[model samples]
Target: MLNLETLSMDQYSFVANAFSFGLAVMASTTIFLWLMRSSVAPAYRMAVTITGLVTAIAAYHYLQIMLSWEHAVSIETGEVVATGEPFNRAYRYVDWLLTVPLLLIELILVMKLSQQETINKSLKLGGAAALMIVLGYPGEVAETIGTRMIFWILSMIPFLYIVYQLVIGLKESVDKQPENVKGLMHIAAYLVVASWAFYPLVYLLPLAGVTGGSAIVAVETGYTIADIVAKAVFGLFIFTIAVRKSEAEAGASGTSASKKA
Candidate 1:
């Protein structure tokens, strides 16, 4: 069902390998954190579990992507031939399609929001995120820079909406978070902004006249870096937020019970 062609690694091989390794680490660490930390508040546990699933899915996809990159170029008698029919440049978008919404959902779950609020925000934000990824794909496969930019700009419409929901729409809710984890929530939100913002900058490089191997390097390496930060590092912050919030809630419960006695 997927490409299994084996060819020489290109300049992007090392970066691809690194990204694969990062995904592996993200998957293992988040799953381990979820399994071993079962005593946390139920909502927080669910959040961590979702984070694990997100990373695990990304890791699987990245492995395929890495292999695809390996076969995209071949060295033949001192000549390099491009041969990535199954290269699957869309793997990243596929990964984003699945994981981006989950990322937002994990943050929402960690906040322990009301049922109606949770469903509403999750649907709106997650739907917007999925649309953003779906819209970006056509641009990615576009044959010309002009068409690509048009699609890219169209994709940004949803992206900007997601950002607005994260920053302004959720401001009051984040403010109501436990004192200990309130700033952590903002940090998590800002990390999402910072990391996700890097993607478009990388995506636009080729349109800006960055051609040849340098463009490949910039696209691959820059995206890999952003992926690490957005998924791996951002997942860590989510874990921290969950743990801290769970502990704070547990302590508050104990205090309330003691007061009742």
Candidate 2:
């Protein structure tokens, strides 16, 4: 069982509200992304489809988290109290492990790079994303600041690689993107870097003296906020890139259908 503390009515409500909101947003985004897939060209459909898949995975995990969270605690006569059940924070890591790599893959597949370049970068970036999540989970579950810091340092190795891939390694790919979507591609890259930075910061909240219930609230809330942007908002960018790329290519599909439907 995870260490869950007694929260203020406000703290308990805040965390509960965050999870509830996350579930709704993720579920809605999944439906929207999937339904719009037919509006994009066939070549780009996979990219848009994968974007939906990311949110779909996220929605299911949020459901799991919300269920666990609701079962973990309650208010007893206006006093927040634990009900002998602890929230399974591992759901967050499990969610990340599956969805994070797919996030990278969607971005890559939408770019329409050469088949070889696509395979190489997708393997590299996707693998790095997976490694980062797996490495960070150890630090996340660690009790001591020392153990957490050690794992944090280790995890940053892959994170730095992801940043490098985004800022430097993928610069050419972003630049080669069609003029209509170039600006958006840069923003998407930066959003990934910025939004993903939230996780590590929240992971170290305890080290920064934000401990106990405050730390719990901060970590859970920060993670949900970050996931919304990283998955849902970023998925929009993926769809846009796919549509723009489709419109740019010969025999492109769904341009009129997209506008009409």
Candidate 3:
């Protein structure tokens, strides 16, 4: 009973191509990091691996969307686009579930590498944040009217946690009087906030469908773009910070060892 005529093939293709390209870029970056693993710290190496895995999962999610579009189009012509239901929605929810915790863990690892005095606090907060995200997953499996409400509430937890960490990091960077660190922290905070800002718009778009409008297509495309920006681009920025912190730590350690000798 879905209308394919409401969706534009050209638009769908463009979004699909963009997502595929972004995934390819992420995959390449992951392989490159693996090749240069020696230059990265052990903690950061784990972060890279986690990031790569999440990226791969995200890539698969986009591919599903693309396939779903094809299926929808085929169904319009009385043909089967593919088998089963579109798993794109499920993939996206699961992607967020995995990404949220991985990001917090990466941030904690970076703080430790930077030798921050409050590393213990950061670790505790990160653990709590991860737990909140984990709790959100049950909503993904929920069935009925209560499911969406639970999902929305649970999803908000990560947003709040990121905001808290962003404020803390920014304040700490300012107190330390380090221009480079402050600049990086400011950018990271902005990206985290920006990612959260897109969620509400994506959530509301579905309401347009009640009017028999083509909001479904718009919502799908909007989310695809948001994920690319938040998960792919913002994620790369986070990884860069981790890499820088690791290099700084390694350099300092070498210098200290030489001085002791």
Candidate 4:
């Protein structure tokens, strides 16, 4: 069994700090949008509100991990050992649980902006999101760390669906000659695909013993950077598109009203 204790302090610190920083950025962006609710479109305002809540939850998970690390270091040196339970082993799964639903909601909202009318898009998205969350429970409750691979495989289904939706939206925007929408769609496509592609590679390779502890740390660092790029930069790109769309709609409505008068 691969032991986290075998890793150096620097390795542990690097992963923890990077993940914490990424989650912090995610949380801050969500909070910022929540604060500016009056200026955003109604759909986007709701999306941001959901994003804020999930981001805050994920941040709490990372914060708990950080505190656990601090406790571990003190214990190693014969200082008073912190005795409380660390985060539930299931918490990481729960973090993903919260994230997948918000992602589906965001995608559905984007699809609406793209002129796709489906009678049951919401129901489909919600059902898929719930399935992913349900599937996560087995991995969360597994007795050994090795069982996480099963979770990864199960989680990949929804992740791939999200990537597929983003790719289709990107292509549709490009073909339709909507420059603003195209730009945002391209960013979303790249971010979603890039961020999710690392999961299986990191977990599977480490479990297979193709990589050691340091390599796991490196993979984690890369994952953290990818997440930061996705949540911070790509998130802002989506926000810009929402604002531009609202402005265009407002201008068009004004023009039509004037012509009618």
**lDDT winner between candidates 1 and 3:** 1
Tens-place lDDT per residue, model 2, 1-261, is 345654677888888899989989988988998898877778888888889999998999999999998888777887777788878889999999999999999989988899999999999999999999999998888878999999999999999999999999999998888898999899999999999998888888778877677777878898999999999999988888887776666434466545544
Checking candidate 3 for backbone clashes, the offending pairs are: none
lDDT of 2: 0.87
- The model with the greatest TM-score is 2
Score residue 179 of candidate 1 by CA lDDT: 89
Candidate 3: where is the Cα deviation over 4 Å? 1-5, 75-87, 113-154, 173-179, 208-214, 250-261
- TM-score, candidate number 3: 0.70
Taking all chains together, each candidate's TM-score versus the true structure is: 0.89, 0.93, 0.70, 0.75
Q: Ranking under TM-score, best-scoring first?
A: 2, 1, 4, 3
lDDT of 3 at 261: 44
Off by over 4 Å in 4: 75-89, 111-119, 133-155, 169-178, 210-212, 255-261
After aligning candidate 2 to the native by TM-score, how far in Å is the CA of 250 from where it should be?
5.2
Worst 10 residues of 3 by lDDT: 204-213
Q: Pick the lDDT winner.
A: 2
lDDT of 3 at 183: 67
Q: Which ten residues in a row have the lowest lDDT in candidate 4?
A: 78-87
RMSD of each: 3.9, 2.6, 4.8, 4.6
